[model samples]
Structures are given as structure tokens and as C-alpha cells.
Target: MRYVIIGASAAGCQAAETLRRYAPGDSITLISDEFRPLYSRPLLTYLLSGEVSPDRIWLKEKDYFNRWGFTPLLGEAVVRVAPQSREVYLASKKAIPYDRLLIASGARPRLPGVPGEDLEGVYTLRNLADWQRLEAGLEGVRAVAVVGAGAVGLKAADALARRGLQVTLLARGAQPLSRVLDATAASMLMQAVGAMGIDLQRYSWPVAIRGEGGKIKSLALNHDRELPVQAALFSVGVTANVEFLEGTGLDDPGGIVVDGSLRSADPHIYAAGDCVQPHHLLTGEQWPYHIWPAAVDQGRVAGANLAGAGLRYRGLLPQNSLSLRGLKIISGGLGPHDAEDCQVMTELDERRGRYRRLVYREGRLVGLTLVGDTENAGIYMQIMAQQLPVQDLAADCRGPDFHPGLLWG
Candidate 1:
């Protein structure tokens, strides 16, 4: 059997590996638009901050494809997929036929189409190329205006501040990470950003980017304020790369909707990663969980099913682990602020800058947010994933003395 996978990121690569292990002798081909070898996308910010070396970002070795006996088509873009013909067409007029196809094409950064967005110093940090360009252009950038307060935006602001550049973080909502974190957690994170010398502005977004001589000069905000900066970086969000599957009847506004087996509307085609929206483990809602671990899990499941293993993916659990300067935070599932049915339990140590909030529904731990202390994040995630009842351990959970042994023993 011939298997073709579109994308070389976390999901695509993991799926290819799983297929190779299950099929052994089947022909496998991995295609990626990026010329560079497979690397961790989440580490781009660390790379910019000089926290991690360039070599450390690569996920695979030089002989990865050769060792696995797979065909590596690098720097090639899939322009279209013909489901009826079972062929994948590339931009270079190359057509590859496959018995099974996996579309893990991933996503691209969403850019705010404001005026002067094409200025020289305006940038987005999505892939390795974007990071390289931004890093090179930072030589004379003293101040940077980062638009958006999501994970990407906050991380970019942190990295820029670490590089000694004045950072102005603009958030469209009233607080950073407003969609995920509760009001208290958001306040704690805001304090951390302030300690790092980043100017955190809430309820602000760019109306237009003003430039002079083709370079960024100032950013005009909706609040009738202007920020003078040499560079502007946007980390708003991402849009799935599903344009290639337009005529395949598999594309959706959120993402490609897949069943339990990760199979698309067409049985011959499967999808994983940020390009597909699977069911949520907790809420049962179908949406794209753009997390690394979710992508890896989906990829493996999809590959197994592709190889006729008949595996069913349970669902995706949305989670985020972020580090701002010295503060570490881990959030998962639905926070207390997201649902009215959730019963919240909290513990706070303002002097120590530590906080924990657990959201329970029907006596089961449905969500959690841990800041400054995340050592037990893994245990909390496991409880939520298994839908384990935590009513008896509620008191223990609210304090730092909480231990896994309490539930087990």
C-alpha cells in the first residue's frame, strides 16, 4: 500500500513513523512546504530569546527518513488533492498517487489586515523562516509593539523583553489570555509581565501601522493612542491550511471535521493536527485543539487506523503550558470562568506568587489552572483525562500539600 502524508510537523511526522512501524514494507511519503528539516514550532520563541540552540530545535536526525525507509519530499507545497483520482498534486506540477492520504497540513499565523501591515518591521512568528527574519531584523529595534495577548503574543513579548527591547503588549480583551485564564490568574500573569518591564495594555489593538521609508514608525491603537516603535509583531492566532482540500468536501470553517477514527468524509482520506477538528474529551465539542501533544496523539491514532489497526481516537483535551520569565503556568480543560456549572476551589499565596484553581463538575475534576507551581500538573491532567471523581480530595487539591498518594492510597 502507498501512503502519502501532507505536512512534516508533529502530527504528520508521528503518523509517518506509526505507519512505517505498522506496515513495515508499505511505501510511505512525507511532504512538507518547509525546506528545513522537522523542528519544534513551539521552540521558536526560545530560539529567539537565545534560550535554546539552533541544533536543539530539530526533532529528527539527519538520517531520519533514510533510517525509516520513507520518501521525504521537502520544500514542496500540495496545491490540491483529487479524492476521486486518489492523487496529490504539488505546485511544481508533480502528482503522487496514494492508497491512503493523511492531511496534517497544520496552520498558518493569522495576520491583522491593518494599513501599513506590509511595512519592513512588521512580522509574525509562526515558522522557522519568520523567526529567522525577525531575529535578523532586531539589530536596531529598540521598542517592539506586540499585538494580541494570547499565548503566542505573550511569549513573543517575553522573549523580546529578555533581549532588552522595550515591549508593549496590546490585548484586545481586558486581560491577557482572557479566553483561557480566569480573572485572578490573569492578574497574576499580568504582574509577572510588569515585573519583566513589559507594558501590558488591555482593551487595545492596532487600527493601523504607520511607517516611514518602508519601515515601521508607530502603531495607532483603537483607544486614540499611538505607540512609537521600530518593530511590530502579531501573534493573534492561526488559521488551518485547508485551502488545498477545497473541492474535496472535507473542509469546514473551524477545520476539517473527522470521526472517531480520524477519517474524513472520504474514507480514503484522513486528517490530524491543527488542520482537523476532533471531539473534545471533556465537553464533547468538536474543535481544533492546536496543541503539540494532541497533534502527536492524533497522528499516531490516524496512522494506526490507516494501517488497518482499527483504532479509535477518544478525543482531544485542550491544554497549555507556558512560562513567562520565571513564572510557570499550566492550564487545561474548561476553566472556572468558562462554565456556569463548574464549582471552583482555589489556593493562593500572594507573597510567594503561587496560585491554583480547580474546576469541578458533577464531582469530577474538569479543569485546572496552576501558576508559579506546576509540579503536579501532570497528575491533575491525568485525573481530568480519566474523568476521575475528586470530591473526597477537594480539600487536598486546594493546598500545596496535595499529593497523588491521597487519591491512590
Candidate 2:
């Protein structure tokens, strides 16, 4: 058996390791457009903070290739994926045949095509190369204006502030991570980040980044506000890396569409990671989630199905976690954006910059948002996943005596 994996990021790397463990005789080829080996992406911000060197970012050292039976082709990009015929064409015009192919092509950082975006000091961080560039470029650079208020963008701001650089963050929406954190929680977060010396620019979008002599210097805002900065980073979001499968029989976009068993719409091939969208465990609706844990789980399920093992893939549950400026934030499940009459509870200490909220629908806990302390975060996720309506009931848990043990069986 031969397995050809693309992207060499979280999902693709996990699939390769799983295949090597389950079927040692299988020949594996892992390709990555990145020059370095596979790595932990969550640490990119840590790298910017000067917490670790570039060498420390690798997920596995060079010995990993020889030990795991993987033929790694680093810094190589796949130009095309012909799943109907099971062949992958490289940028160098070489084609590799495969019995099974996994398209985990990961994702590229999304950059809004505003003016001066091509300027020297402007960037969008997604890969190690991007992180390295930003770090090296920050030399003698002082103020930075980051466009986008998600985890990555805020983390970048956090890194910059720690380095004593004046950082101004801009968000198109009124709230940071509006897709994940609700308005109330986002407001609280904004207050916390503001106290830490970050200029939070909400309800603002970049119209044009003004550059002097081909280098980023100032940016024109939607509100006609111009801000000066030495550098800028746009950490908006990402789209799937599916352009290579252009002629492939897969569905639209960079990710291939897969069913409950991780089978593509074509059935002959499978796709996972940031590329593919899985059925939501709660909504039962299909959409792409660009989280690392989900991508890894998706790859594992896909690999199992490809090994001819009958494994029923339970759709993914949405969960996300983040650590910003020493404050840990974790959230899970969905709230009543469409539905009402939710039982909501909050524990807030503004002086300490701590807030926690849990929303319950009917008699079951549905969603939660926590900051400063997330030790029992996973327990809430477990309850939501299990849909358990337990001892204290929804009303009782909402009170001050909310025992932590309610999370247990």
C-alpha cells in the first residue's frame, strides 16, 4: 500500500504517523510547501515573544522520517491532485502514484486586498516562514497595527506588547472573535486587553495601507482615521488549500467534500484537516472549522476508514481554547443566536479581569465562555457533548454554589 499525503501540517502529519503505526509495510510520502519539518502551529506567537528558537518549533526532528517510514519532501508544493487516477503532481512536474491519498493541504493566511498590502513590512502570519519573517522584520520596528481581532491577531498584539512595542489592533466587526465569543464576552475581553496597553480599534477596517518609498508607514481607515506604524499584520482567517484539486472530481474549493465515513463525494478518495468540512455534531450541518484538534481527529477518522476498517465516524463537536497575555480563555458549543429563553449565568470580577459565563437551553448546558481560569473547561465541553441534565439541574448550577464535581459521572 502507498499513501501520499499533502500539506505536511497537523492533519497530514497525524495521518502519516497513524498509517505507519497501523500498517508498517505501507510506503508513505509526505510533502510540505514549508522548508522546515512538521511543527506545532500554536507556538508561533510564542516564537514572536522570543520564548523559543526556530529549531524548537518542529513537531518532529529529522530522525522522525527514518523512524516513521515517511519519505518527506519538504518545501515541495503539489500543483495538482488527480484523485480519479490516484496521482499527485508536484510543482517540479513529477507525479507520484498512490493507492490512497490524503488531501490535508492545510490553509493559507487570508489577506484583504487593501492598498499597500504588498508593502515590505505588511504581513499575514500562518506558517513558520511568516512567523520568522515578522520576527526578523520587527528589528528596530516600534509601533505595529494589526488588522483582524481573532486569536492569531490578538496573540500577535500580545507578543508585540510584551516586547515593549506600541501595538494598535483593528477589527472590522464591533467585537473580537465575534464568530466565537459573544458581544458581552468580547466587550469584557476588549477591556482586559485595553488595560494591558493595546489600542483596540473596533468597528474599523483598513481601507488602504499607506506606504512611503514602498514600505508600510501608515494606514487609512474606513472612518478616515490614519494611524502610523512600523509594521502591520493581517490575521483575518484562512481558506482551504484546494486549488490543486482543480480538475479532480472533488467538490468546490480547496477542500474535498466527504461524507460520514470521511469518503469524498467521489468515494475513491478521502480528505481531511482545514481543507474538509465535517458534519457538525450538534447542528448536523456541514461547514469548515479551522481548528487544529478537529483537523487531527478528522485525519484519524479518515485514515481508519481508508485502512478498510469499519469505523463509524461521529461528526465533530465544536470546541476552541486560547491563552492570551497570561489569561486563559476556553469556549465550547453554541448559544441562542437563533433561539431564545436561554438560562445564562455569569461570574465576573472586573478588578481581576476575570469573567465566566455558561448558557443553558431547556435543562441542559449548551455553551460556555471562560477567561482567567479554564481548569474545568473540558468538563463543560464533556457535558455539552454528552447532553447530560444532571443532579442540580440547570437552575441550580447557575447559582454561586456551582460545584465542580457536577462535571463527573
Candidate 3:
């Protein structure tokens, strides 16, 4: 079997490893637009915080490439895909015929159409190159404005703050982490961020960027609020790198569309990760979860199926947990559907800056938001995933007695 995988990120690496194990003698080709080896995207923030080093960022070092007997093509762009023929054409005008192809191109930073957006000193911390740019620009940088208040943006801002750069975080939404965190939980997070001395500008849209000498100087939010920024970082969002499949049979929210088997509409093509819209087990909706876990899981499923073992993807239950500055924050699952008879409970201790809430749907834990009491978060999430009825869940939410034993029916 000849295995061809594009976009050498988490999904690609896992799929390649699996292919090597299941079909040892098969030929495999891994393509990546970036020259750097596959590194963990989530670790970039920690890398910036000096918590992790670059050598440790890679998923596999130089030895893994040689050991697996796979072809590694880096610094090459995939220009086109012919799914009908099961061929991938590269920017270098080389075409590779694949018995099976995996499209894991993943996502790239969304570039806004605002004027002067292409100016220098504006970085998006999506990959290692962006991280190095931000690090290089940090010298003598006093003020920085970060666009988008999503988790990655907040984490990037936190890192910048630790580096002593005065950060101003701008969000088009009314609050921080509105998508992931509930309104009440977001309010508590904002309060904690305020104590960090970081300036937050919510409910604003950036219209244009101003630059002098090809370097960013300032940006006007809707052409009214203009702020001087030594450098700007935009984490607006990500769009999948699917332009190469324009004429191919693969489809996407921005990348390729696939079925439960990770098979695209074309039987010979499979896709996973940020580019492909994988199913969510909770919602039964097919959309790019764009998180680490989903990518890894989908990649493994796709890998097994590629190696001649038919394995159906089980999807994922979108979960993301991380801390900003010094505040511990976590949110997961869909909260109670109509708060009536929902057995909702919340406890807040303002003095200690701790808050916890658990909302149930039909006696099953559906959503949970906790700050400071995270020791039992994983169990609550697992219970929520199984839709198990918690006898004392409401009472536990009312107070801080979240011992795992009490989580039973």
C-alpha cells in the first residue's frame, strides 16, 4: 500500500505512525508546507512562556523519519489534488500516486481584509514561525494589541504579559471566551484578567491597520478608537488550507468533508484534523473541532482504515482546558437545556476567588464550569459524556463537596 498524507501536523504524524505499524513495508509520503518538523501546536504557548523548549516541541525527532522508512517532504506546498486518480501534485510540479490519501492540511490563521494587513510586525501565533517572529520583535516592545479573545489569543496575551509587554486584548464579542465559557464563567475570568493589569477592549471590530516604514504602528477599531501598538498579534480565527482541493473530490467547511469512516465523498480519499469537519458525538454535527484531541483521534481512525483495517471514527466531545496568567478556568459540555427542574447549582466564594457551577439535563451532567476546584473536573466531564445521572450533583454544585464518590447515582 502507498500512503500519502498532507499537512504534517498532529493528525498526519499519528496516521503515519499507525501506517508504519500496520503495514510495515508500505511506502508513505508525508508533505508539509513548513520546513520545521511536526511540533505540538498547544505547546507553543508554553514554549513562549519558557516552560518548554523548542527541541522538545517536535513530535518525532530526526531518527523517527529514518526508522519508519517513510518519505518526508517539507517546505513543499501542495498545489492540486486529483482524487479520481488518487494523485497529489506538488508545487514543484511533482505528482505522487497514492493507493490511499489522507488530507490533513489543517488550519491557517484567518487574514482579515483590512487595509495594511500585510504590514510587518503583525504576527499570528499559529505555528513556530509566528512564535519566532513574536520573540524577535519583543526587544524594546512596550505595547502590543492582540486581536481576538479566544483561548489561543488569551494564552498568547498571557505569555506576552509575563514577558512584561503591556497587552491590550481586543474582542469583537462582548466578553472573553464567549464560545467556550458560559456568560457567568466568562465574567469571573474577565475579573481575574483585570487584576493582571492587561487592558481589554470588547465589542470592537478592527477596520484598518496603519504602518510606517513597512512596520505596524497602530490600528483603528472601526475607524474610531485608534491605539498605538508597538506590535500587533491577530488570533482572529483559522480557515482550513483546502484551496489545493478545489478541483478534487474532497470537500470541507474549509477543507475536506468526510464520513464516519473518515472517507471523503471520494472512496479513495480520507481526511482528518482542523481542516476536515469531524463529527461531534454530543451534537452529532460535522464541523471542525480544531482542538488537539479531535485531531489525534481522527488521525488514528483514518490511519487504521488506510492500513486495510476498517475502523469507524467515534468522533469527539470537544474539550479544552487551560489557565491564563494565574487564573484556573475550565468549561465543557452543553449546560442544562431549560433551567427549570434542571437541578442547576452554583457556588461562589468571592473572598477566595473561586466559583463552580454544574448544570444537568434530564438528571445527567451536561455542562460544568469550575474555577479553582479543578481536581475533579475530569470525572465530571466523563460523567457528562456518559450522560449519567448524579444523585448529589445539584447539592454538590450548591457547595464544594465534589468528592468523586458523591458523583454516583
Candidate 4:
């Protein structure tokens, strides 16, 4: 059997490994648009902050593909996939036939449409290329305007602040990480961000990016405020890289919709990672997880199914872990926004810089958010994943005496 995987990130790489392990005799081809070897995307901010070296970014050894007995197509972008012909067409006009194809092409950073966005010093930190350009552009930059207060934007601001650059974080919402954290949790996080000398502006976004001589000079915000900055970085969101699947009838505006087996409309073609919208484990609603772990798990499942393992993905559980300076945060499952039929419980200790919020639906722990203290995050996630009853242990969940043994008991 011939297997072809598009993308070399977490999802694509894991899928290839699973396929090789399950079907050793099958021919496997791995293609990636990035020229660099597989590396951790989550660590890019650390690299920018000088916390980690470039050598540590690689996910595998130099001869990873050679040792795995797979054909590597680095720096090659897939232009189109002919599902009928069972062939993958590359931008180089090369065609490769495959009995099974997995589209884990992932996503690219979304750019907010604003005037002067094409200015020289404006950037997005999604790929190594973007990081390289931003690194080069930061040579004489003293201050930077970061658009969007999402995880990517916050991380970018944090990294830049670590480099002694004045950072102005612009958010379209009332607080940072509004999608993941409630207002209280967000307020606690903002305190830490404020201490870092980052100007956190709420409910503000770039209306226009003004530049001088083709380089960023200032950013005009919605509230008639203009801030002078040497550069601007955007981290609003991401859009799935599914334009290549345009004619394949598998492309979706949200993401490629896949069944439990990760198979798309065409049975011969499968998709995983950020490019595919899998079902949510808790709500049974389909949405893209976009997180690294989700992509890896989806890829493994897709690859197993490709090898005829007949596995069904259980769906995704929303989970995220983030650190701002010394403050740590871990969130999973649903939030207060999904509180229509849910019970919300919260405990806050502003003096100690700790907070915990738990959401319950029909006596089952459905969602959680922990800040400053994340002692039992794994246990919490396990209970949420298994949909275990937590009504009896509800009182103890917010206390320090909470233990995993209690759950099993």
C-alpha cells in the first residue's frame, strides 16, 4: 500500500510514525512546505525570548526520515489533490500516487484586514519563516504593537517584553484570553501582564497600520487612539490550509469535516490536525481543536485507520495550559459561556494569586479553569474525559485535599 501525508508538523509526523509501525511493508511519503526539519511550534515563543536555543527546536534527529524508511519532500507545497486519480499534485508540478492520503496540512496565522497591513515591519509568528523575518526586523525596533490578546498574541507580547521592547497588547474583547477564561480569571492574568510593563488595552483593535517609508511607524486603534511603534505583530487567529482541496469537494470554510474514522467525503482521503473539524467529546459538536496534542492524537487515529485498524476517534476535549511570567493557568472542557444548563462553581484567592472554577452539567464535571495552582489538572482532565460523576466530590474539588484516589473510590 502507498501512503502519502501532507504536512510535517505534529499531526503529519505522528501519522507517518503510526503508519510505519503498523504497516512496515507499505511505502510512505511525507511532504512539508517548511524547509526546516520537524520542530516544536509551541516552543517558537521561547526561541524568540532566548529561553531556548535553535538546536533544541528540532523534534527529531537529522536523519529521521532516512532512518524511518520514508520519502521526504521538504519545502514542497501541495497545490491540489486529485481524489479520483488518487494522486497528490505539488507546486513543483510533480505528481505522486497514493492508495491512501492524509491531509494534515494544518493552518496559517490569520491577518486582520486593515490599511497599511502590507507594511514592512508588520508580522505574524506562525512559521519559521515568520519568526526569521520578525527576528531580522527587530534589530533596531524599540517598541511593538501586538494585535489580538489571544494565546499567540499574549505569548508574542511576553517574548518581546522579555527582550526589553515596549509592548502594547491590543484586544477586541474585555480581557485577555476571553475565549478561554472568564472575566475574573482574565483579570488575575492581566495583573501579571501589567506588572511586566505591557500596556494591555481592552476592547481595542487596529483600524489601520500607519507606516513611514514602507515600514511600520504607528497603529491606529478603534477608539481614535494612535500608538507609535517600530513594528507590529498580529496573532488574531488561524485559518485552515484547505485551499488546495477546493476542487476535491472536501474543502470547508470552517475546516474539512471528517467522520469518527478521520475519513473525509472521499474514503481514500483522510484528514487530521488543525485542518479538520472533528467532533467535540463533551458536546458532540464538531470544531477544530487546533492544539498540538489534539493534532497528534488525531493523526495517530487517522494513520491507524489508514492501516485498516478500524479505530474510531472518541472526539476532542478542549484543554489548554498557559504561563504568563510566573503565573500558571490550565483550562479544560467548557466555560461559563456554555452555562445554559450547567452549574458553575468558583473559588478565588486574590491575595495568594490562585483561582479555580468548575462547571458541572447533570452532576458530571464538564469544565474547569485553574490559575496560579494547577496541582490536579491531569486528574481533572481525566474525570472530564471519562464523564465521571463529581457531585459527591464537588465540595472537595476546590480544596487542597482533593486526590485522585477519591475519584476511584
Candidate 5:
């Protein structure tokens, strides 16, 4: 079997590795638009702040693909995928035929349609190339503005502040991390962010970026306010890089729709990671799980199935964990929209800056959020994943005594 994988990030790399084990003699081709080898995308923020060295950012060891016996086509972009002929055409006008293909093109940073976005000093932290370009532009920068208050934007703010740059974080939402954290938890996080000396701007979005000499100079906000900054980093959100599969006849609504086995409409073409939307076991609603761990799991399952190992992906739930300015936050499962039929329990200890919220649907734990103290987060996630009854263990779900032995036994 000749395996061809597109995009060469976490999902594509993991799938290639797993495919090698299952089909030892099969030839594998890993295509990437990046010339650099696989590296930890999450560590890009650390790299920005000089917290980690470039040598330490690589996800795989040197000569990984050479040892694994796969062809690495670096610095090549996949232009189109033709399912009819089982061929993938690259930007170089070369078409490679494959018996099986995995599209893990991943996500690209979504920038607002504001003016001056193409200025020299504005950057998005999606890949190593982005980091390199931003680093080269930051030589004389004194202050920076980060757009959006999502996890990526917050991390960028922290890194910029650590580098002694004045950072102003702007969020269009009412509060920071509003999607994952409830009002109570968001308040606590906002307080922590403020204490770190970073200017937090809520309900504010850049209307237009003003630049001088082809470099960013300031951002004009909604309130007729102009914030001066030498550089700007936008982390608003990401869209799947699925433009290449447009005419392939595979389902693409925001992302490629996949079945439980991560297979697309064409059985031979499978997809995973941020580029594909997999169904939820509980809701049967298809959505993209862009988290790193979920991408790895999806890649493994897709790889196994491609190797004829008929494995079914159980399902995936939304989960996130992050530490910012000494505050640790963890969230899982449902959010506010699906709380109509759920019982909500909250605990707030403002003095200690800790908050916890748990939601139960039909006496089973459906979602959880914890801030400051996330020690027992694993227990909550385990219970939710297994759909264990938490009505009887109410105290455990509400308070600190989360003993898993009672449920397992």
C-alpha cells in the first residue's frame, strides 16, 4: 500500500508513524508546506519569549523520517486532491498517486478584514515560519497588541509582556475566555490577567490598523481610541485548510465531515485533526476538536483503520487546560448553550481566587470547569467520559473528595 498524507503537522505525522507500524512495507509520503521538520506548535509562544530554544522545539528527533522509512516532501504545497484517480497534485505541478490518503491539512490563522493587516509587523503565531517572520520584525519593537482573548492570544500577551513589551489584549467578547469559563471563572481569570500588568481591553476590536513605512504603528478601536504599538499579533481563530479538497466531493462544511472511523465519503480518503469534524458520541453532532491531544488520538485511529485494523473512534469531547499568570484552568464537555436540560452547581471562593462549576444532565456529569485548583480535573473528566452516575456522588462532584475507587469497584 502506498500511503500519502497531506499537511505534515501533528495529525499527519502521527498518522504516518502509526501507518508504518501497521503496514511495514508500505511506502509513505509526508507532504508539508513547511521546510522545517516537525516541531511543537504549542511551544511557539515560549519561543517568542525566548523561554525555549529553537533546538528544543522539534517534536521529533533528527532523522526521524529516515529511520521510519518514509519520504518527506518538505516545502511543497498540495494544490488539489483528485479522488477519481487517487492522486494529490502539488504546487510544483507534480501528481502523486496513492492507494490511501489522509488529509490532515490542519488550520490556518483567520485574520480580520481590517485595513493594514498586511503591514510588515503584524503576525500570526501558527507555524515556525510565522514565528521566524515575527522574530525578525521585533528587533526594535517596544510595545505590542494582541487581538482576541482566546488561549492563543492570551499566551501571546504573556510572552510579549515577559519580553518587556507593553501588551494590550483586546477581546470582542464581554469577558476573557467566555466560551470555556462561566461568568464567575472569567472574572477570576480577568483579575489574574490584570494583576500581571497587561492592559485587558474587553468589548473592543480593531476597526483598522494604521501603519507608517509599511510597518504597523497603531490600531483603531471601536471607541474612537487608537492604541499605539510597534507590532500586532492576531489570534482571533482558525479555519480548516480545506480549500484544496474543494472539488474532491468530500463533505466540507467549515471542516471535512468524517464518520466514526475518521473516513471521509470516499472510503480510501480519510481525514483527521482540525481539518475534519468528527461526531460526538453523546450528541451525535459533528464538530471540530482542535485540541492537540484530540488531534493525536484521531490520527492514531485513522492510521489504524487505513492499515485494515478496523478500529472505531469512540468519540471526542471538547477539553482544554491552560496556565496563565499563575492561574490554572481546565474545562471539559458542554458549555453554556447546552445547559437548559442540565443541573448546574457552582462553588466560588473569591478570596482564594478559585472557582468550580459542574453541570449534570440526567444525573450524570456532563461538563466541568475549574480554575486556580485543577488537581482533581482528571477525576471529573474520567467520570464524564465514561458517563458515570454523579447524582449519588454529588459531594464528590461538588467538593474535593473525588474518590474514583468507589465508581471503578
Candidate 6:
């Protein structure tokens, strides 16, 4: 049997490994647009800051595909996926036949629509090649503007700041990470990020990107405030890369829709990673969990089922973890804007810059946010995942020694 998987990122790599272990005799073909072996995507910011070399970013050995006994098709882009013919067409005009297929194409960075967006110094970070390109273009660059206030943009701003470059971060909203962290927690994070010498510009929405001689020169925010910038990065978010599945009969409103087993409507085709959205375990509503851990789990489940193991994926739970200038933040489950019936309990220690909050609905823990100290984040996530009754601990959940083992008893 021939098993084909597109992409070679976290999800694709995990699925290939699982298939190799489960069906040792099956022929596995791993196709990727990247020529390099699998590497850690989270460490790209560290690479940008010069804290880690390019060699340190690799998560696998040089000859990982050869050792795993799979055909490596690196630097090949999939142009079309014909579900009826059970074949994938590549840009090189080659067709690969497969009995089972996994579409883990992942996502690409989303850049806002503004004038001069296609300027020479405007770039987005999504892959290793993008990092190398951006790095190469940073020569003699003194000031830069990072558009967006999400994790990606903030990390980029921090890395630029660490390199002694003046960075101005623009956020459309009032605070950074407004989607995940509440107002108070966001304020705490803003304070720490500001201390890093980053110019935090809240409520600044880009109207146009002005350039001179086809190079970025300044960015106009709201038609008035113009900031000089030599380079700019658009890190607002990412969109699913499922354009190849346009006529493949897959339900892709914005992402590929998959069932519990990570299988698409077509039985032989499966999908995982950011390109697909799964049902939420708690609400049974379909939502996309674009985080790294969920993608790995989805890949494993997809591969196991493709190997005839008949596994069922639970669901995707939202989670995020970040650090800035010695301050750590971790959050899981629903956010404050998720539901109106939630009861939010919070605690803050200004001196230590620590803050924690718990969201409860009908005496059950639904969400949690921790800043500065996240040692007990695992326990909180476990409780939320299990849907255990946490009314007893809601009042004192922020304590250092809140025994989570009691839930098991």
C-alpha cells in the first residue's frame, strides 16, 4: 500500500513516523516544499535574535527520511489533489499515486490589505526560507515596524529589540493578545513588553505603506500618524493552505473540515494540523485549534486510523504559552469573550508582576490564565480537559500548592 502525505512540518512528520511504526511494509511518500529536514517552528524567533544558529533549529537528523524508510520528495510543491483518481499532481508535472492520503499542508502568514504592501522591505515570517530572506535584507536596517499584536508579532518585535534595532509594534486593539488574555492580564504583559524598549502603539491601524524607490520608508496609521521604518513584518495571523483542495469535494469554508478520526468526507483522504478544523470536545461545535500540540496529536490520530487502527480523536482544546523579558504567560480553554455566563475570578501581585485568573460556569472550571508563574498550568489544563468539578478550588486555585490529585480521588 502506498501512503502519501503532503507537507513536512510538525504534523506531517509525526504522521509519517506513526505510519512507519504501524505499517512497516507500506510505502510512505513524504512531500514537502521545503528542502531541509523538519525543524522547530517555535525556535524561529530565537534564530532571528541570533541566540541560536540555523543548525540548532533542526528537530531531526540530516537523513531522517532515509532512516525512516520513506521516499522524500523535498522542494516539491503539490499543485492539485485529485481525489477521484487517487493521485496528487506536483509542480514538476509528476503524479504520485496513493492508496491513503493525508493533507497536512498547514497554513501561511496572513498580511493585511494596504497600499504599498508589496514593497521591497515588506515581509512575512512563515518558513525557514522566509527567515533567511528577511535576515539577508536586514543589513543597515535601523528601525522596523511590526504590524499586529499577537504572539507572532510580539515575538518578532522582541527579537528585533534584542538586536538593538528600534521596533514599533502596532496593534489594532487596545492591548496585546486581546483574544487570549483578559484586559488585566494583557496590561501586565504590556508592561513587561514595554520595558524591553519596544514602542507599543495601541489602537494603531495601518492605512497605507509609503515607500520610496520601491523600498519601504514609512507606514501611515489611521491617515495621520506616520512612522519611519526601513522594514516591516506582517504577523497578524495565518490562513489555512488548502487551495489545492478547491474542487476535491472537501468542506473548506476557511479550513478543511474533518471528523473525529481526522478523516475528511472522503474515507481514503485525511487531514491534520492548522489546515483542518475539528469539533470542540466541550461544546461539540467546530473550531480550529492552530496550536502546535494539537496538530501533533491530530497527526498521530490520523496516521493510526489510516493504518487501520480505528482510533478516535477527542477534540482540540485552545492553549497558548509565551515569555517576554523573564515574564511567562500560559492560558488554556475558553477566553473571556467566549461566553457571557462565565464567572471570572482573578488575583494579581503587582510587586512580583504575577497574575492568575480562573473562569467558571455552573460550578465547573472552563478556562484559566496565568502570568509570571505558570507552574500549575498542567493541572489546570488537565482539570478543564477532564471537565471535573472545580468549585472547591475556584476560590484558591491560584495558590502554589493546590493539590490537583484530589480530582482523581
lDDT of each: 0.89, 0.79, 0.81, 0.89, 0.86, 0.88
lDDT of 4 by residue, 110-154 (tens): 888999989999999988888889999999999998998988888
lDDT for each residue of candidate 3 in 143-213, tens digit (9 for 90 to 100): 99889898898888888887788999998988887777767778888887777778988897779999999
Candidate 1 lDDT = 0.89
* CA deviation > 4 Å runs, candidate 4: 404-409
Runs off by more than 4 Å, candidate 3: 335-343, 387-392
lDDT of 3: 0.81
Error of 2 at 89 (Å): 0.3
Candidate 1 RMSD computed on C-alpha atoms after optimal superposition onto the true structure: 1.4
For each candidate, what TM-score against the reference?
0.97, 0.93, 0.93, 0.97, 0.95, 0.96
lDDT of 2 by residue, 312-399 (tens): 6577777777777667778877743622567667777767666787876766777788877777887788788777874434445545
Over the stretch 75-160, how does candidate 1's per-residue lDDT look in tens digits?
Answer: 99999999999999999999999999999999888888889988999899999999999998999889999999989888989999
The superposed Cα distance between candidate 3 and the true structure at residue 357, in angstroms, equals 2.2
Provide the RMSD of all predictions against the true structure, rounded to 1 decimal. Answer: 1.4, 2.1, 2.3, 1.3, 1.8, 1.6
Candidate 3 residue 48 Cα shift, in angstroms, is 2.7
Residue 301 alpha-carbon offset, candidate 5, angstroms: 0.6
User: Given candidate 3, what's the lDDT at residue 277?
Assistant: 82
Error of model 2, residue 43, in angstroms:
0.4
Between candidates 2 and 5, the TM-score winner: 5
